[model samples]
Target: MQEFISYKNIQIAFTAEGKGKTIVLLHGFLESSSIWKHLTLELKKTHRVVTIDLLGHGNTEKLGYIHSMETMAEVVHAVLFHLKIKKFSLIGHSMGGYVALAFAEKFPQQLEKLILLNSSPVADSEERKQNRDRAKRLVKQNKKAFISMAIKNLFTDENRNALRPKINTLVEEATQIPEENIIAAIEGLKNRKDRTKVLQQYKGEKVIISGKNDPVVPFQEIKEIAEQAHSNFIAFEDGHMSYLENREELGEKLITLFS
Candidate 1:
């Protein structure tokens, strides 16, 4: 069911369904909880599924001009706390993964598992930070152009034409996001700290799922992260948007991991 919780005087939107060991899904930057619709339909059958629109995304309101990963994690905690959910397996995609790591650091006892999909625990490298600055400027100048290029770049060249409709849909949804929110998110991601230690110290079930051809987070780095963090690794044969490019495989893998 759809619900909202007041966080810092703003409504934080979320959806919860089914009834079992709770599982919380967090989407990447430029994405909201709605991105998990396809997986939620299946995962809810055996697990209580909850997807929250992180601060500045989906139905949630922006907290401020700088929506840090730590703040986003707090918002997730508020939603679950309001719902009386004590423990849950957390799955985060892209930017969501950064939030998950922050959550793990603050609420280790409450998390049963940490799964990073198409995301890395490493902080923004110098080049990436520069890229983010450029992106923010571009967003302020031509939001539509930035959104179009950003979404398209998520997929490989081979899948671009095949997934044009889906890509367009993503672009459409992202375009609705205000320029400030986009800039806020970019700032958060660019400043996010390296949480490799948190992942390595996490004693619960941990997994890192990545696409072999992911341009955002390199496949080799993720594989090494899995090893360093002692996380079970699952690799898909595609680019970043594995949920769309490797739907069936990802769904099955998630079920097995969450179970």
Candidate 2:
């Protein structure tokens, strides 16, 4: 069932399903918990799954101020605490993965396992930082235009054409995000610090799921991260949104990882 939980005076929307080990799914930036709907249905047959809309996304109430991943992590922690869930496995994608790492650093004891999908522990590179700054400026000037560009960047050219309707839906949704929230998210991302050390500090079961054709998080980068942390790495024959591109296979892999 889906419900709302109060945290930091904001109403966080979350959905819980199934009956076994608890697994929390966190979505990427500009996306909502709805992105995990299919995965959650498959997981529910054996595991209890919880998916949440991060602050400023989806149905969740957004605070006026911007928040870093650390603050976002605390919000997730609060939701888990309220549910009386002492420990759970966490699956995060992109921005969500960053938050998962930050959360693990702050409260490692509360996590059973950590899975990162198309994500990185390192901070934004100089180019990415400059890109974000450019995006922020564009958002101020033309929000809709910036969101459209984001959609193109998110999906591969082939996927964009094949799944035009679906891709457009996502882009439309993102375009609707409050301009203030967009600014806040961009600011938070730009200012984010490198958490590579956080990965080294974690000593639990860790899985790094990457997309073979992911233009955003590229295979080489994933390889470097896995090598550095000595974590398990899996590659999908797709792009950044591998979970969506290879749902059934990814779901099966997740079942095994949590088993």
Candidate 3:
């Protein structure tokens, strides 16, 4: 079932399924809670899976203002608190991973375990900072064109070519995002603080899942995060969206890790 909850003065949309150990799933940039539909269905058989559309994504309200990692973490906390869930495992991908780290820093006592999928703890590098600025400008100039460019960067060449239709659908959905939301997200990305220290500080049951061929968050970075956090690392054959591309395998890994 799906519901809306107030957080940071915005109404956030979330979907929950099944009934057992609670697990919260967070999506990456330009994606929504719908991205987890398949995985949620599979995991629901044994667990209560909750997937949320972060502020400014999907049906969630956009504040028309930029957000900080701290603010985003508070939003997640509010969602969980509203559900009366004191402790649960967290699964986050890409940008979602950054939020997860912030949450850990603020509310470590509430987390049972942390799973980062195709994500890293490092903040924006100089080049990435520049790219984010460029994206913000491009979005202001032409949102549709910018979204098309983003789609290319997300998928592998093979998927881009073979799954053009699917890719286009996602891009179209992204293009439909409110201009305020896109701008807010870009600003958030550009201003996000480095969390390497937080990663190093955390000493918990953690798992880092990476895609062997991901260009966004490379294998080396994943290795560094695992080593720094003293956490376990798992690799999938696919690229950035490994959880979606390798749902069954990824699902199995998650089930085992949280079992």
Candidate 4:
């Protein structure tokens, strides 16, 4: 059922479905709980799946023009705390992965496992920071173009044509995000800290999934980060949108990871 919790005085939105050990899913930037439709439909058959719409996106209220990952993590904690959930595994996609890392750092006792999907624990490199700056400008200059290009680039050349419909839907959804919120999310990501140490010290399982041709999060770099964290790195033939483009295969692996 859909529910809400007042965190920082904003009604944070989330959903809990099915029953069994809990698996919390956090969506990437410009996405919301709806992005997990396919995965949840399958996984909820065996596990109680929880999906959250993090700050600045979806149905959740915007925290501000500068949402730190730390703050987002705490907001997540608030939602789970309200539900009285004691323990769960986390699966985070892109920006959501950043929040998961922060949560793991602050509340390791509640986390059973951590999965980074098309995301990294390292802070933005100089070039990426520059790109985030450019993205901020692009959003102000031409919102539609910015949203279109961002979603289109998440898919690789090999499958863009096949996934045009899905890309179009994402573009439409992203276009609705307040331009300021987009910039805030970008800044939040750009200023995030490197949390690989959390993985290195974690006693639980750590899994990292990356797209071979993802333009945003490079695969080679992700493999090295996973190594430093002592995580099991899984590579997808697709790009950053593997969660959508390769749902069947990724879902099977995620089931195993949660198990």
Tens digits of lDDT, candidate 4, 114-196: 99999988888898899999999999999889989888888888678997888888889988888888898988988999887
lDDT scores of the candidates, listed in order: 0.93, 0.85, 0.83, 0.88
Please list the residue runs of candidate 2 whose C-alpha ends up more than 4 Å from where it truly belongs after superposition.
Answer: none
Q: List residue ranges in candidate 1 displaced over 4 A.
A: none
Return the candidate ranking by TM-score, descending: 1, 4, 2, 3
* Residue 16, candidate 3: C-alpha displacement in angstroms: 1.9
Worst 10 residues of 1 by lDDT: 250-259
Write model 3 residue lDDT over 1-259, tens digit each, in one string.
6799876577889987889989999887888888787788878898888888887888888865886667777888888888888888888988888889889899989888888888888888999999898888899899989888886676677766866776777788887788889889888878888877777777678888998889888898778779878889998877888765677899888878867
TM-score of each: 0.99, 0.95, 0.95, 0.97
Cα lDDT of candidate 3 equals 0.83
Q: How would you encode candidate 1's per-residue C-alpha lDDT over 205-225 as one tens digit per residue?
A: 998999999999999988988
Candidate 1: residue 178 Cα off by (Å): 0.4
Q: After superposition, how far is residue 104 of candidate 1 from its true place, in Å?
A: 0.4
* Per-residue accuracy of model 2 over 37-136 as CA lDDT, tens digit each: 8888888898889898888888887766675888889889988888888889999999899889989999999888999998988898899989998988
Task: List per-candidate RMSD values in Å.
Answer: 0.8, 1.3, 1.5, 1.2
lDDT of 3 at 222: 79
Candidate 3 pairs with clashing backbones: none
Mark the regions of model 3 whose C-alpha exceeds 4 Å error after superposition: none
